[model samples]
Target chain A: MSEMKWGWPVIGAALFLLSAFIPLIADGYWMSIAVTIAMYTALATSWALFSGPTHYISLASGAFFGIGGYLVATAMSDYDLSFWLMLVVAPLVSALVAALIGFATLRLSGVYFVIFTLGLAEMIRNLVSWVQNNFLGSRGLYVLTDFTEAHIYWMLLVVCLVIFVFGWWLSRSRLGFALKIIGNDEEVAKHVGINTALAKVLVFTTTGFFGALVGVIIAPRYSYIEPNQVFSPELSFMVVIMALLGGAHRLWGPLVGVIPFALVWETITIAFPNSTTFFLGLAFLFIVYFIPHGFAGLIEKHWLRLRS
Target chain B: MDILVSGFLLAGTYALIAMGLNLQYGVARIMNLANGEMIVLGALAAFWAFTSYQISPLLTLFLAAPLSFIGNWLIYKFLLRPLVKRAKNQGQLEVDSILATFGISFALVGIMVSIHGEYFTYSFLANPIEVLGSTVAENRLVAFFIALAIGLVLYLWLNHTRAGTSVRAVAVNADSARLVGINVDKVSALTFALGGAIATVGGVLISTFITLDASIGVIFTMKALIIVIMGGVGDIRGAIIAALILGIVETGVATLVDPGLTLVAAYFIFLLVLLFRPQGLFGRRST
Candidate 1:
């Protein structure tokens, strides 16, 4: 193991501890912001697993997240399933759905892939809204549980840590290398006997799993899951922004990207409540243009230069 | 019969929208993700001009189209050109174009939401004309004619004109076109400008019939993309035919099924087309 690689886990552990203790030191409003940042980090990291490695942009992360939230709500409310079971089942179902989508659409590349996923997401969102309105008789599902904010926070922290470690491992593993090779050149990877299609499908499905997992965690925290709020295009846009801002392929990039993004979002929404979308949109554009590597990329480059 | 006629008209509108995107994507090979935002800009500009100045809808197109063309040209020259240069340097024009265009799209949406509040705005210059014992809005009829005229003009220009041949040559292969003494960059810029102009006209037409909101362009963009895909990329004739078919299908479904499900259905069809014929109905397979 390289000494430089050790820094990631060290930083991650420190961040986990800092995030857990932040609520204790901060007030309710600040805690709420922290929670939001943590949520985005989880979601963005989940997205990075697919987009960063395989370079297959799945614009349906928000859809999977929404599906997970809805599944948990339904399981708890209608089926009386335990919270733990909901967590496991929700992501599993999302992964299965993502696999189906991947099987159909992942063959296309670049803009075509983006367009197909965007269409699929819209279709799923419409379907969900239709079901919620017609059958559920509610625009959103609400959770009625004895769970406290602290319990939810702790649950999020554990999940985030597990996801981070998994992401770290994936980035270092042979599968990770195969994904990178495919991203760089599929023909060459295939020439060398890598099953490019299977690798892409696996990454796509796994990313959906984590996205849904984050959704399950966040739904209980908010205690509500609405089709519009959960399956928003804006949410998908924000996750892509987060991953891009942090450096798409970097582990811990999402964490680094999410903290600043969430903070800016919170601050902007507080100050310009009505016009926050405009600012966020502008910020996304600015980051994409000027800071292509995002905040994490900037830090990594500068830090490496300084160290060297 | 009404569904058929209306569908054809609606498809004409979609063709206008997809024409610009087709030029940008098919001919220029630029993966412009921000195509939808440009349509929004056009629609908003026309709407604002009509609301604020009470300009005639016809006159508004004259004003809006030029402005959108100039604005998009400037964006390509200043913002997108640099990225294209970088892509050339890296030997990966397609990937870089996708990233740059994605950024531009996000920025455009932001600027739009900032300038035009999220509320839906209706076009003020409204007049209807009767045709075949059916009431067709004058603006819709005018928009349709303008779109048809533009499409015809583009086809004629591309097929019969010297500059059009040069643009097609460049689309076929930039390096070879350059070797043959064609000014590839100029052709690309012109094609991009043409696309911008077409989208602007589409924006004006669409706003006349539907409510104009900050987000409406995205839906239009999606529809245009679907049309382009269905029509087969790079085949202008196919795009035209496919646009009409899609418009009729969408309108018929909206008439028969839930209006909201219309887009879902259209998207479902797009997936089916992609699965069965990935190159699109008329698109050539990429070599």
Candidate 2:
């Protein structure tokens, strides 16, 4: 089902490694930007993994990401756990939540599913809001990080690589095939003997795992962590936009979408911070209406036309 | 007693908003992610009219509703119609429409924010009137009555009017309606217009009670969406009941606990409903 040739994976591996060298060349500012790019790349990749295949536009990434953040923040704040321990536990925690939510939400179709996923995130955020208000006394959680920006960049890089490789592998996996078939036609997929619900849940769980894992690692960078900041709907919209803007169907599509968006995000932050969200919405409209296939597909189409 | 009356009034206002969404989603089968934008646009109209011409928001409802109606008619005719036509299947259409309307929502919100800045509040009558031994804002009572009047009018239009029959027919089966010489496209456009008009009135009502801003639309978006689903996708009566439950719950939570949890109550109900009753409280059970 992956249908990827050997050459593409080889190229992807080389390009990924080249990205790791950014910290060596760039200063701290650029290093920070690069790290953000890597984080979004990982997010977009995981998002594409689930949503691209199933066509189930998920709005719960922010919730999962926040869950990861709060989980690690609580651990550090209360239990004083090591960052390394969270490297394993955070994703697992997120996966559990995803599994629970996916069980109920996976049955929803179309717009109901989208709204529910969004509401799911909001519900979690509110739950966290309650916990923070009642138990934590409305004070923000803080974590100690001895690592420099470069270390953070490398951590993000490693996570991004793991996601990309897994995505590459999944493209060829049985589950991936099942998801694609379900995406094309759920009834047909069932008729063909695939468990559509199971495949959908797996996609949701896997994506949730990465989304939270990244949040666990990234939370230490921010000194103060609050539920509202981590669990905003805008964050969910960001990853979904990146995945959709790239050709979600392809492994590298998210990367294509992420690189440009991350760069634009950097520039826009410096130039006009408030307008970027608006612009992101405008960009979504243009891409969905004009170029639904995304940049990767646009390139493929052009190449195909030329060859023909 | 006061809480009950206040909650019922709040419920009435919510029904006005949710009913429009029902018309659009149930009858026209358009999710209209920009549904909140229509409401916001109505608020903006009222605010603008009030500021420039010294018109009362209650009086400016006429201005806001028609403008929103025309604005949504244009959106449906020009933007949504073409893209919807191009979609291959229901799934494809759903995602595309969500994205497109989302885009419109952003563009409109952005324009409003840049022009007016994010924060806004339109003040109305401050004097509290006693209603059945409970002191309530006059604006709230008026808003409740207006919402109730419109809801009744909409129900009558759907049940009695020829256009209402056509809308119901289109909702039941678009192809069948089209085959029977009902103009499905026109009904859809009219539904969007009607939805826009009613949502605008809801916005006008809320602005009377609360400080209106560009971001408030996001809150209404979540609330209306939850009410629509909790009531059953396209059932108007269900939408009203669900709206009342949510409005009461939200106000009760705000009164008893934290005001912030008002939205939290909405999310809680939405999740509980989805988990136990996916078809919604009032919707027919579907496999």
Candidate 3:
């Protein structure tokens, strides 16, 4: 058990060490791709941490992620606050909002929760757009920063590592066990004396924090943060797809989904720019129909067959 | 007075769209995220027929409904059936169906964008007529009357027809429906197809006044979902009332406040309903 506990992290650490040097050797385009992969990896991973176990499938990642970007943009552009301060404040605010949303909708049936989350994201986007148009007198905010692409990449890598480590720790924690039980049978979990709502909210709050933090780190890449662009429902969908494709059930699953999807998406974007949405739609269909359990499930199945 | 008349006109069109969703989600138990795409496609077909061949939208409606009915029937048979069959539980089915339809919506949008690549609008009955001292567009009046006629027919059919009773039975309980010799799967598939056809019909009507693009499907989907939820899920009368309320609120907001805030107002009302009356305005709370 001890060996198993240490083995995964050691391999994870080695992989992290190897990935840390990509900026030094890769070309500009490749570095940008890596940044994209890293950003999605972080987003998908954090997203899976909640949706995976609870099976609630919150589509509000856009709201949280956009909040992060909007905060950093508003603070740096309007208030002239330091980026460092945003790093602290943005995620905290995201957690608060997520907790509110979680409490409000988590008790409902799964369908209502999904719909509410989707609506909430759209509502926030509309609200932001309205505010920008009416009061700000601009459609977007410029988030100019001295940080380079490599710096952003490195920060995302670190965030990825932190999330992975936290996820690893969480898997062995009491809350994790409670979450697993709730995911399996909420009524049973309630009878077993677990505060199911609290457990779900805590995990959701953490996911929101990570989602926002990624938005904060990635905001500089966009330079100009528009409400429509940053608060996009597409981002929320992509995060959900990537995570589900990788198998949200496992901690390391989203990474597995992120790498291939990000690469394929990059190719498709360049090759058939017009048909990207078409292909994206196809991707969702294929994943849901064929690989609903994700690659991780397939691997586990294969492993079990071999052993048997 | 103007608001009431215009609101009623708007509600007349929205009723078909919302009822389509009500049938699908309320009866078939599939929360089709692609519903808006179906609407857009219907609008596209109408636009194509009207502009390319100079056929009336009324004429195009006949072609669009049967075609969409067959298309959605096929979707249910091939794509959704597998998911429905394999889903271990209701929750699993909901998740799978939502994701699949979401994908379908994207695919539909992609196909539409490739084909049309622009907004579609046409002049259909653009003349104005007086209504209770205020002038309303002739097209909107026509749309209202047609919608009212269709809605009445649908209400009667659902309440009076044997097939409609089975559909309602499936909505009420699939297991009991099956026990009573009703083919649950067939009814579900038919209901889904009917929903799609109705949405297309609504699109044909809406396209008379509103301009449509490939990407505007999600907005309509959201609106339909709001109405379906606001009204009782399976109750057609509730959906009609909800649609009317939505139309009035939207028109009032558009006229009184900013036009851009109309969606905001609809969402706000939806949120209030969700928070305060999750069962819906006319629905009895489920045990």
Candidate 4:
């Protein structure tokens, strides 16, 4: 109804349009990198939807992502399931897993909660890797169906748009306010009669759902799934970096964070492959120390100052 | 009998690592994600010293401890101190610490890789000592005793000294400690130095058992986390007991189950304990 309220969606639409033309304008190598940035943006934004608001850090995003990939791989390879069914089933399975884990561990807070989720992720990764190695008789799973990269690009675009809309809606909803209260001060929230534990569980499950959705879409594009790539700590680290670098608690933080990081990583990896981590480390330190508010924060502050 | 001997020896080394984490997380209340990188640094430093100078591994521990302590002190002075001061303004120092430490860990891994290459480097003193009808490698056994001595010294220093009281007071409440005329920053620096020293000892012992590599620190860091969690935060005696329990359980599990399953099982145990006793085995419930 209000002009200001419609601005976010308009921006989202413009970005989507810009992304649709990226593959056409860019070379194959850049296109591939662009695709990665898009995937990480989706994952990071989905993760930030819960963590940025609630402060319940789930170190298990990689596990959910891996589960989604494995689900698609197994469905396609073992059962001859269609790509469409794999995408639906994978996210649903991941959501259910998240619900169970959340119910079990949502009561803990701070460092304990973090370590618990991390442990759960590690367990799931090991279980999946063991199954792939022992039961499947392979170190990784490959997609049987032939699919083009363009198909993946379009699919990810659609999925990312859906998630973005979902995030925007959630951030404005009553539930988001409840999460904000719990994040700021749980004891005060409990005193005010908010169901703090339930809210946390719900947010965790929702985050897992979106993360798994991204994983399902990307699995076919890669045409293969390995436990290392799917369930590595690097995935979790990347998401955190994206969220923090883009300005946690902002809607478009992930997009701002993931795109630049992906670009820099791609460029540096090509020039000096072994030194990428060193450079990334230096960049990370600089961002944490000097640019604590990240890019989005800078944007928000400058915009407010200009208005004032 | 052999299992018992090995378990005790391993427990001693683990105690050293857990003590380092305990000092940082417990005493300073600063969760250093780069704690493992400090261990890696100490190990690599000792490795370099041994290979280049042909020094005995025993002497390297003494040499490495101060180096690691100074390195970590610098991290606190340059990197962490400024962030801590800005905590009131930022309101996200915890998250910042995690990111900064993660960066440090990555940087350390890169440095190690560049210096030592990707291949595992084995450095051991070629000797064994027969004790209690079991043959213990000389380096490992000596490292174990040295770790025990360090642990004792730390325990006494923390319990029976005036400076230790100031450190404990600051850990409880920095503002109140300042009100009571305690120098909180100096105490924090001392705690960091002590933690670094302990980590260096752990590195020395760990290097004796396995070949040194860049990625080795992460696992050890995780294991130390498990030990500290199981032991109870801010409780040194509890850490010693917990380390022994973990050492026995891990050694037994490795011997019985697949060696690869050790971390999975330990983490599972951690999850289980957290579900029931979130404060840990010996930690007091917070107000």
- All predictions: root-mean-square deviation over Cα? 2.6, 2.0, 1.5, 2.4
Candidate 4: which stretches are off by over 4 Å?
A117-123, A134-136, B1-4, B89-91, B123-136
> Runs in model 1 with CA error above 4 Å?
A1-11, A14-18, A78-80, A134-140, B88-95, B118-138, B284-287
lDDT of 3 by residue, B71-186 (tens): 99999999999988998988888899999998999999999999998999789999989999999989899988888898888888998999888988999999999999999999
Return the TM-score for each candidate structure. 0.93, 0.96, 0.97, 0.94
Stronger candidate by TM-score (1 vs 2): 2
Which digits, one per residue and each the tens of the lDDT, describe model 2 over residues A81-168? 9878987898998999888878877877757678877656667777778867887687668877887778888888898888887887
Instruction: Tell me what fraction of the real C-alpha contacts between chains A and B each candidate also makes.
Output: 0.40, 0.59, 0.70, 0.43
Candidates 1 and 2, the one with greater lDDT = 2
Please give the distance, in angstroms, between residue A254's alpha carbon in candidate 2 and its true position after superposition: 0.7
Candidate 2 Cα deviation (angstroms), residue B49: 3.4
Question: Which candidate order results from sorting by TM-score in descending order?
Answer: 3, 2, 4, 1
Better of 2 and 3 by TM-score: 3
All candidates: TM-score of chain A: 0.92, 0.95, 0.97, 0.92
Q: Model 1 Cα displacement at B258 (Å)?
A: 0.7
Candidate 1: tens digits of C-alpha lDDT, residues A51-136: 88666666787788888887887787767888788889889998998887787777666566777766566677787777667677
**Interface RMSD, candidates in the order listed:** 2.5, 1.7, 1.3, 2.3
> For model 4, what is the error of residue B253's alpha carbon versus the real structure, in angstroms, after optimal superposition?
2.1
Candidate number with greatest DockQ: 3
Candidate 2 chain A: worst-modelled 10 consecutive residues by lDDT: A1-10
Backbone clash pairs for candidate 1 read A245-A294, B128-B138
Q: Alpha-carbon error at B45 in model 1, in Å?
A: 2.7
Q: Candidate 4 clashing pairs?
A: none
